[model samples]
Target: MEPIPNPSSAHPITEERPGEAPIFDWDWTETLAQSWETLLLILSTFWCILLARVVTQKLQLHDSPNLCYAVEFGLVILPCILLITVAVDYSNYIGFVMFSGTLWFLRKNRVLERARTRGQFDLGGNRHMALSVLRALTHLITAINILAIDFGSYYRPYRKSLQFGAKLMDTGIGLFVFTMAMVSRRTHNWSDLRRIAVYSVLPLILLGLARSATVLVLGYGQDIHEYGQHLNAFFTLVFTKFFGALLNILARKDLHLLPLGFGILLIHQFGLSFLGVSDYVMNDDVDRTNFFNANREGLVSLPGFVGLYGLSIYVNRWMVASSLLSYSELVRKLRRLLLVVLLLWSLFVISAYGIGISRMTCNLGYVIWMLAIGSTSLWASFGAIDFVINSVMPWESSPSDEQEKGLVTRGTVAKGGDKSIVSFTISQALNQNGLTFFVVANVLNGAVNKFLRPEDRSNCESVIILLVYMFLGTRMAYELLKRGIRLA
Candidate 1:
């Protein structure tokens, strides 16, 4: 063997070469995995908004005026604290710095405006000035926290700061609730409540839809850097859209919907808790992952969150129909049975899609999961609202004289000469129908992403099919929206 060198042995011959090729160094930080932290951070931020809104609505219903003010204050203050803490630990100080700069600019601009408007400038808006000052202080604290989080190599150094920030935020939130309770005792107006409800709920629905879309689009193509950019863009877009919708809703004073929405939310929470117990026993492995990430581990995984959310919504819908609805016992039982069946069916669909199709792709299952979760949530929410409205405010005809005069009663559809009834009926029907279709589209979208990707057990043909389905769904949504607008 030594006498005759084996031709197959390329290693020995290559070793005799003068120099070895240089190995390219790869940085994990440049990859998508590293950006998971950013995604989690953004998710937490969104949760803050959701919590604030939910709490605000709850307080509003109790007629607590001071509580509302407190909630608003807490909403601004608490997040600033948490964000500051996280920023400090993660060395992400930009948010705090930008916030401070914004305050300074606003103050200067206010002075200039006052000077121009009046001969002598007077910043005598003491309350407003105090609030601004508080905001500045919060901003400064947040900036410090950001620096600590982003730059702190060791967690120990920032642990105290983190705890302190959380405590401050919590205390601020508590104060806000207390204030709202005090204020609610003095206010009572049903019409105003209704207006608030409509405005808040509608905008939330739209904002949720937009955010879900942004997540799906951004999660596509498996490019880490692009993914980060998309995540940032999604946050920015969500903030803008939510605030715009909230402003519009506020202008209309449609606050009454808060109670109904809060009720639905409470139902949703109960459903989620039930699902958690069921999932723990039935899907131990998945449960293990979810628990590890959500509880034991600090990392927040999107799929785990969606899966839990979807289960919660499905459960909530059942609860609303069976427990909350004013149906006969038999009807309630039947509805419960049907809900269980649907829940099982949805689970089957998701599992099959995941195992049979999603194994091939990097994050396709997650994308589909998010879409499905969004759709289910919207459907359940709307359905709950419908059920509550019908139960509490059943359609009733007016007295003979009122009816003859062609006046439209609160829940009654007007006849012949009045088009309001027809319009109202059409709008409600279209909205409900549109929501159902939207849920179906979400499920289908998930299926496509799971089974149609090239990495999945499919070729380009799968993608084509998926695209066609999406196109059809989009067209349907557009038509529904048009009908809705006409009715409105």
Candidate 2:
């Protein structure tokens, strides 16, 4: 094999190897590639159908006791599968295709109109809950699939998967909203359902099983054989440096988790940076063991790293405060903090982009990804602001003409002589579904960045930056929540 080019020193931009061109046709030589594409499409669609059915059933059984089951499946199972599958292959394109197809079906059936008129409620008046479940499920699945597939690795397959998955998720969500609109129009008084249907129970159970199986079947051997040594070392370090601090926090109630979390994060950053720099220095020859090469190798292995990080954060946080605060309070504060951090982060990221574009040999794709992160952050920040504002503001009274037209205007007078401000406000905020999108988008961005960027910096630097931003963001979020709660 030809010697690996030195990334630090002068290196020529290499030409593509034969058959490595982006638009290779599906001939005998590329049959395996084509087959993989086909398999992904089929599997993704199957999963989509399963997801849609679960969502539909959840909405239908809104009053039932199994409501939480749907929520759990949507939030946990769907996202996990999405993450794993997206990492596996070109599943994202399949999702997009499926989503688009779903949309067309909904449009043809007039489902959208019905959904809008009904306020997207189910027949039993739990539209919001149902839609929330569905949206979460769809997004998680989509995001996971996207993460699994490398965009540039197999260009055509990756592109197709992304397109298909995007369309599929969008359509699934659209159908859900449309159904909800129709359901919301109906009026009924009902109790939450307590009965469980086989349809719901079986699917969720199977999905759970599948997710576990997938993790084990795909991850077990690789984790043990390939990454076992390094992973064990990393975990040991994490335990000594981070987990120990976390346990102390748990034992001492007075201890603050955030500071501990931040400190651990900083340590992680330092460690990663040292490793990256040391690896670079040791591999002075123009070999595949250089800093950039090591970085790429680490990047490719980041999902496991991030999973550990998430676990560390959760364990630390949960140990200190059983219930940190109420969801409402959390949401309120998180929203405000998100807005401020997003603004600052956007500026910093933009500066990074300028540097990357002007000085570094970055491509259009890198620029685009950076821009997307900025855009999504801005969108999510604004969404949180909008939710907070609407929640606090009094609703405007509807005109008599709107009343005559039987339209649910901004704020209508109720029989109790109180305006429907509270109801309207809460409804509007929930309907935006901003929180769901924000989480999904952030996760997706992280996954993309982990894979795409040139791994010049050490793990320490990356971890440090991540921790610093997260700490600042969380702190701001806490303050915002406190302020909002006080105002209320």
TM-score of every candidate relative to the true structure:
0.21, 0.29
Task: Compose the digit string of candidate 2's lDDT tens values, residues 103-124.
Answer: 6655664643433332111111
Q: Where is model 2 more than 4 Å wrong at Cα?
A: 1-255, 271-331, 340-344, 347-488
The CA lDDT at 320 in model 2 is 22
In model 2, which range of ten residues has the least summed lDDT?
Answer: 356-365
Question: CA lDDT of each candidate?
Answer: 0.30, 0.31
What TM-score number comes out for model 2? 0.29
lDDT of 1 by residue, 11-78 (tens): 11112223432221122222122223322333333334334433444343232323433453355334
The parts of candidate 1 lying over 4 Å away from their true place are: 1-364, 383-488
